[model samples]
Target: MDAKETLSGLPWWVKWIAIPVIALVVFGGLITAVIGFIVGLLFKVLVFAALVGGVIFLVRRFTSASSSSRGDW
Candidate 1:
């Protein structure tokens, strides 16, 4: 049988609701996954930045103190 004949066997509501509902579910899943990946990447970037800043701070403190001690001699 043709597509129309096959679909016509089902109730009209099934045809209308089933197609749209399935489409929404598939599209929604894809949207959710993309959003999740973006948020996770942002989190990783922020953490890496914080670690780099902390290392710079410690190095600056140690070097300044060593320099001042030598200058006093």
Candidate 2:
């Protein structure tokens, strides 16, 4: 039988609720792990951007300060 015919033969609750619940029960751990990995990757990318920006700020500050001091040397 085709998918549409199979689904039509099932009860409404079975189609709407039971299938989803069963799917979650079967793959919940896998779904949670995949979501966790994506979140972690996003967090690490944000941290990397923040660190690079901080380094650039520090370099610019020091360079300007040293250039000003160069005239006194």
Candidate 3:
């Protein structure tokens, strides 16, 4: 039987509310762990980008200042 036909007799709450609640209860820890891991990964990536950018900025500023003082380019 098609899924639509099978679920047609069920109430709306069972399809929307109850099913989602049951799924969350069953997989809440897994879901929480996945989200936490994603957040942590994004935070680490942001930190890495900031540090790299700072290093590049400082290097360019110092290099340009020294080169300009030397009268080259």
Candidate 4:
């Protein structure tokens, strides 16, 4: 009645290859969806970070340039 006793009688391919293939066939969609969501979230975070950095750089560049032009430096 134990799993080890049941699996021991099966062929090696059944234990290794068949079982894993069957599991993926059952749960593959959920696994793919979860992975896709994580990748998309990471991409959005990277894009937001780039936009914020660009804004900071432009602000600093223009502010410094205008102040120097005004002979404040």
Candidate 5:
């Protein structure tokens, strides 16, 4: 039979059982999303730290290089 015929044949208890199962599935999806968000935040923090550190290193190198060149002249 087609899906509509199969659903219509199911007893009332079938619908009741479906409710809690659907709720559990939805709750699982929400938990997965929260975990993914936390992991993404950690990755962003690491990337930001690396970028800031690189900029500071570059600025220090440029300042030291310029100061040494001026003394030589």
Candidate 6:
């Protein structure tokens, strides 16, 4: 009949443990791929942000040094 009725007849381990284990066994590869992709994308984004920040820092440092040398500061 319904899921509750079907699961209720089963043991606790079957309902909680076995079903989840079986589902993971069936879809483990897909789940792992999705997680790996997300992690890789996040890592790439962090690297890009760091590079942009470094460029900005270098530009500001050089501009300040050059302006101070010319008696502007």
Q: Write model 4 residue lDDT over 1-73, tens digit each, in one string.
A: 9999999999999999999999999999999999999999999999999999999999999999999899966
Estimate, for each residue in 1-73, the C-alpha lDDT of model 6 and write its tens digit: 9989999899999988999999999999999999999999999999999999999999999999999899856
lDDT of 3 by residue, 4-49 (tens): 9988999999999998999999999999999999999999999999
Best by TM-score: 6
* Model 1 ranges with Cα > 4 A deviation: 1-23
Question: What would the per-residue lDDT of candidate 2 be over residues 1-73, giving only the tens digit for each residue?
Answer: 8999999988999999999999999999999999999999999999999999999999999988998989764
Best by lDDT: 4
Per-model TM against the reference: 0.60, 0.88, 0.87, 0.80, 0.61, 0.89
- Shift in Å, residue 35, candidate 4: 0.7
Query: For each predicted model, how many residue pairs clash, with residues at least 3 apart or on different chains?
Result: 0, 0, 0, 0, 0, 0
- Name the lDDT of candidate 1: 0.91
Report lDDT (CA) for all predictions. 0.91, 0.97, 0.97, 0.98, 0.89, 0.97
Error of 3 at 57 (Å): 0.0
* lDDT at position 30, candidate 4: 95
Give per-residue CA lDDT, model 5, range 4-71, as digits (tens). 79778788777679857888797988888999999999999999999999999999999899989899
Clashes of 3: 0
Q: For model 6, which pairs clash?
A: none
Which sequence of candidate numbers ranks them by lDDT, best first? 4, 3, 2, 6, 1, 5
Clashing residue pairs, candidate 2?
none
lDDT of 6: 0.97
List ranges where model 3 is wrong by over 4 Å. Answer: none
Q: Looking at model 2, which ten-residue stretch has the lowest summed lDDT?
A: 64-73
Error of 6 at 4 (Å): 1.7
